[model samples]
Target: MQTVNLGIVAHVDAGKTSLTERLLHATGVIDRLGSVDAGTTQTDTGEIERRRGITIRSAVVSFTVRDRQVNLLDTPGHSDFVAEVERALGVLDAAVLVLSAVEGVQPHSRRIMRVLRSLGLPTLIFVNKIDRAGARVDELVADVRRLLTPTVVPLGTVRAPGTPGASYRPHPRGYDQRLAEVLAEHDDDVLAALVDDLPLDGDRVDEALRAQVAAGQVHPLLFGSALSGAGVPELLDAVAALLPPSPPAESDPRARVFAIERDPSGERVAYLRAYGGQFRTRERVTAYRREPDGRTTATRGRITRLDVVGAATDRAALTAGHIARVVGLTGVRLGDQLGSPAGLDGRSHFPAPTLEAVVRPREASRTLALHAALLDIADTDPFLRTRVAPDGGTSVLLYGEVQREVLSSTLVETYGIEAEFGPGRLMHVERPTGTGTAVEIIGHGFFGTVGFRVEPGDGVDYRREVELGSLPLSFHTAIEEAARAALDQGCHGWPVTDIRITLTHSGYWSPITTAGHFRDLAPYVLMQALAEAGTRVFEPCRRFDVEVPADRLGPVTSYLSRLGARLDGTAAVPAGWRIAGVLPARLELEAQRRLPDLSSGEGLWSSTPGGDRPVSGEPPRRARTDGNPFDRVAYLRFLAQPPSRPVAVRDAGPERGHRSPR
Candidate 1:
């Protein structure tokens, strides 16, 4: 059977999870339908998700549609969980984007569509909730074309929409002139037939539609009510007929692990999607990960357990084009390409979280437990970076307020920890302002010596002026890792970014020097160099879009202006005026909360990460999570004591919050 990895994606509460349950039932994968409200959905098995009726993780479930074995990925709809959607995108062959007919095209809806188009994934737009009251199927198609892509072709129409009996009617063969025109935009045969006023062949049109859909040049739009099962059968048929199947698997073993979850026994389970070759249980496999230095590193691990999706038995082997739950790969992480680096880059698809808040344990006695729990949670969602200070203060990066709430609840429900969150703040970074160099000679306090020259660059560029083989690979790696870690806290205590550092000199006492010696010496020397170079702090900013009644534009703009937003342009949209601009991420929450009131609840607002800019005044400082490397006495004192467990290292390398080996 052909395999299809189809992702179900949408804005929050668009019935995406509902659609998954419906699909499973329609394909006889399940005996009864599971409701999101009742919290009985197959994919949303987490306690918090069931209680909150939300999807926090992207879930994979398998079912069959005729001869096709479909591995359906139900992704989180809330914008806070876009990271989950991004990971899912890396593994999917195609996608089914669900939109609510009642809500029409939402801001997140447009954002996801843009990402889909950018990735060139063959998509099937399913306009759902047609049976809900106030649903407008026909108008939504127009809205989709206007707000989303203009190349979408409506595959069918809705009958008795906005009612309980709402149903779908597939278009009759050769009846859609728009379909011909859409195809003709790229098809020479169709264009010739249309230009010459020649009769178009129905068979030709049907064939062209399938080919275009598979090529990601066109999207097939379908109407359905996942709640009532209206038009669901037709949607399933369209999925089988329209979307492309998995490409032929190559002979080389290539796969990517898109997600990681802990099983009931607390063992880590990695969701691996194989694109080629095969690996059996007990087989040793090499996982490949691209490092920050543009180099790929390989780690070998034996697969102790493997269960293929849709297999009747616990499949001992994973083949190409199939997803499997594999355990005992200690070195594997989400988005790690196994066997070969043949998949998409696992580096962040979206910008890092712009907002951060300090999390204080309500009872000071529980601080250590809270920190440990947060680190454990970060293992599953790497984007939820947790930072810890020497003073025991802890903070977490956030996407938005909704994610904040979910995380707070998760801590209480899962870890039984009560915590208070400080007001959100923009995550700022520092960049080197000039060139400076420093050197630490051997025997000053340790057996290793290191020197580094620091200056501005495109990103965290680590180079070596010293010869490659002058020291052992492990020692070199240790120095590089420590240099990057030291930059986590710059002169102003914010993480340093957009900087270049070259190791100018290195020395180690032949028998006495260890990797730890270089690790300890590298940070001290690098920070001193950074202090000499000086740095500038930049605050995160966001690109925003607002639509409100023209009459409300003045107040909206005024409110935005007060938030220090820089307006780029204002144009008249169908229902209102559209204003676009860049706003400080720190003020985004206030703007999001006030826009509805300013427009009498009709204002629509959306924003995306717009990079960062230098602060206008004295730069703000974050508490240093790394030992204060700039203070030589304090840092050496810190190194003398037993090292405390590090908090989850976000955007940092190798050591990613795991406890060091004894």
Candidate 2:
């Protein structure tokens, strides 16, 4: 049987999880359909997700259709969970992007579509909730074409007889019209045959459409009401007929590490997608680590187990064109690829974390435990990056609030360690604005002095990259370490951004200066130099998508203007107005609270941090009230009083309310 890995993505409330359950039931993988409203969806297994009636993480499940195995990855739709969707995309062969017939294309949907295009993955569009009233299929399709991609063409339509709030059934004629359009676009010959009014065969049309889809030239759009199971069988048939199978290969040894997890037995498992080559059990493979020196070293590890999809037992050897779990390798980090000859570069192209928070254990004794638990979680999800601040605080980089909550829950449940989180913060680095000199003096007559210039670099978003070399390796390492430490405690206790530093020449003691001594003193000297040279703070900004009722549009625009946000654009959604804009991070919380109030609870907004910008404008002014008349009168009398005159020599000795001069 052929196997295909596909992902289902959509905006929140677009019926993604519900559609997933319907697909499962239609394929006989499940006995009954699970509902997201009831918190019983099979894919949303986490307690937090079930309770909230939303998917927090990506869930993978396997089922069969038309004698072909289909592995489905159900991903979260909320923008906060974008990292989950990104991770799921890395291993998917293709994607099914679901859209609401009434809502059309939303901000989240557009974002995911951009991601899909970036990855160069073929996609299918599922227009769900067509049974709802006022569901304009033609209008939604047009909006999708304008916003998402023009390649998405409807395969069939669903006709329902009702008003905006009535139940309806799918009309067969509408479905046939859509199918004919799809078939006509599949190939030139098919189009000609359809135009000539000649009979077309279903099997031939399916084959042609599958070929077009696999080539990424077109996306077949289908409509379905996952609730009523309308057109579900046709959707399943498309999944089996249109999705491409994995190409066969013989031991080419190229695989991507899509995810990392820990088994019940506590062993780390790296989920791998082998595009080519057979990975045999007990075979030694070389792994390479990316290092700063540009030298990669190969380490060998034996694969103890190889488990593949549809395998009945553990004895089966995993081959190419399969998602498999390989174990028995230690020292392998998440996102690291394993292969022969050991020097091949295997890296996961995931986005950097957007938000960060500091984590510390409630009990000091559990610090080590908390650290270990965080590392494990980070391993499982490469999107979470952990760094230790110079002040001994642990900082965790997260995607958003949902990830923050998940980390908190994992800490409490998995490790039995209680921890507290500081406010979400942005990471900034210090760069030089101009050339400056710094001097480091070691204990007992050892000194190192260096001349460096900090300036702007090529990267527009980052503060700047530090470029310095030609000095002794020991001294250079110390200087780099010092620069990093200086950044941790920025000039005014805030992180620095968008600046670069270059190290020129340095003077060092030949006999007495040591690396350790320089390392200890370099940071202080760097801090002093930065203070003398001057540095500025940078703040993060976000790209916000705000939706409000048409009547509340004026209030929404006014609120955004007051918050110092810039309007990108606006569009008319099904039941509301969508305003896209950018706002500073400091104003995000306030905007979130005020938007709903301004729109009378009819407005909704989502935002993602959009890099840092140079700090601008002066701080806000303080307010003061008028003083009382008594205080004013006292002030006037004090001002009118003459200054005390100098006393004579004899009188200077002592006086009432006066000091004596000797």
Candidate 3:
């Protein structure tokens, strides 16, 4: 049977979980429906999720639909948990974007659609909650077209019994004929049929619709009320009938680890979507992940166990077009390529977190335990960044107050350590002002002279383009890796971005200088190059859309302008104006607090991270590490430490973790 991986996603409280529950019930996967509020959800099996009535981790379940096996991944709805959604997307055959009929298209819903298009994932639009009071399927459909895509066409509409429009209907297989002209504009076959006067009934239109949706050229919008089960059956049928199918498997066995979880037995479980061939228990596979020093280390491990879509344990192999939970990869991480450990093309789509906090246990003795516990559970919410700062302080990046609370509660419940967080500070990054080089010799318990040239540009992480023959493969690899790791923090506290570096010299005795020497001191020399370049800090900015009463436009504009904002444009809305602009990310929170007062509670705002701009008021962030690379005494002082000490994590870029949802 053909298998399809479908993800259900939406903004917070848009009825994503409700939709998942209704799907399972409609498909008969469960005996009865589960409620998100009652913590009775099947996919939301995590304690944190059940208690909070939200999904923090992606959960998978399988059911057979129309001779096809469907592996449904329920993704977290809150933007705070977007990393969870990104991980889910990497393995999905297609996606379903759930939106509230009453609220229309929300800011997050639009952002998710944009991301879905960027990834080239075929999508189906479902306008949910049509039974709710004030639900306007027409307006919602229009918003989906305007904000998401022009090709979106409704399958059908929902109206209350005795109401003015079409009443609620189920199993309506016929395509709305009025939309055929629009379909003809995109589908050649449909246009050919129309031009030739070929008889086109619901069957012909159905064929056209299926072909278009499978090709991703057109998206069919369906109206539904998950709460009342008004359109649940049709939605299920549409999922089985409309979305694209997985491509034929390649000859070679291939898969990518998209999420990582640890079992209570201390076994490392990896969630992966197979792309080709099959993976069997006891099969040896190459694993790829960045070491703490930033090098892509390759290792081989035997698959100790394999669980494919909750199949029988006797099932020994997982074929292509399936999702599996396997154990025995000690080092695999989110986005790790399975076939070749040498592949570095694997990348994570999660955005950089914008807020950070220093977290410390109330009992100082539990510091190590706190770090270890946080690292383990941190995968539940990948954006909840837990990293050791350059100053040896442990910190976490959060989405907002809810995340901080969740982290604290989770830490206490899981790790048994009471913790508190320091005030949150907006994340900042710096770029080099100009080109600079470091060639001076500096050694710490090793012998070698390292140097690199630093230049500023667009890419976020470090890229090496050095002559391979200049050094041995291992030494060359270590230099590139160490140099990238060194950029974790510039001479300033903010993370650094958009830089190019190339190795210039490695002066040392080839036989005498160990690879460890290059890895350990490359950061020291790179810091020298960065200081020479004289960096400038860039503050985080956001692109915003603020909806306000038309008469109150002046008040909102004046308010945003004072917060160092530059208005991009403004459009008229039914009740107000949709003023769009760019502003510091910090100002967005303040606007949320003050806009209601200024607009007399009629303002709504949405924002996404924008490119950084030069700092206007804040000074350059201070470096926590010793500033001078040539200072041997201070450099050695920083390097000498206990064996258990975890080095400051390198700047190789973001890595996401998988969660068990505990």
Winning candidate number (TM-score): 1
Q: Tens digit of lDDT per residue, candidate 1, span 163-184?
A: 8998988888774789999999
Off by over 4 Å in 1: 291-295, 312-314, 360-366, 412-420, 593-601, 645-662
Candidate 1 CA-lDDT value:
0.84
Full ranking by TM-score: 1, 3, 2
lDDT of 2 by residue, 533-565 (tens): 665556668888888999999878987897788
* RMSD to native, candidate 1: 4.8
Colliding pairs, model 3: 260-658, 550-576
lDDT of 2 at 240: 82
Tell me the tens digit of each residue's lDDT in model 3 across 305-383. 9988844223677777888999987767776767755335545555667888888889878888988888877644445
Quote model 3's TM-score: 0.89
> Which 10-residue window of candidate 1 scores lowest in summed lDDT?
653-662
TM-score of 2: 0.73
RMSD of 3: 6.2
> How far off is residue 440 in model 1, in Å?
2.4
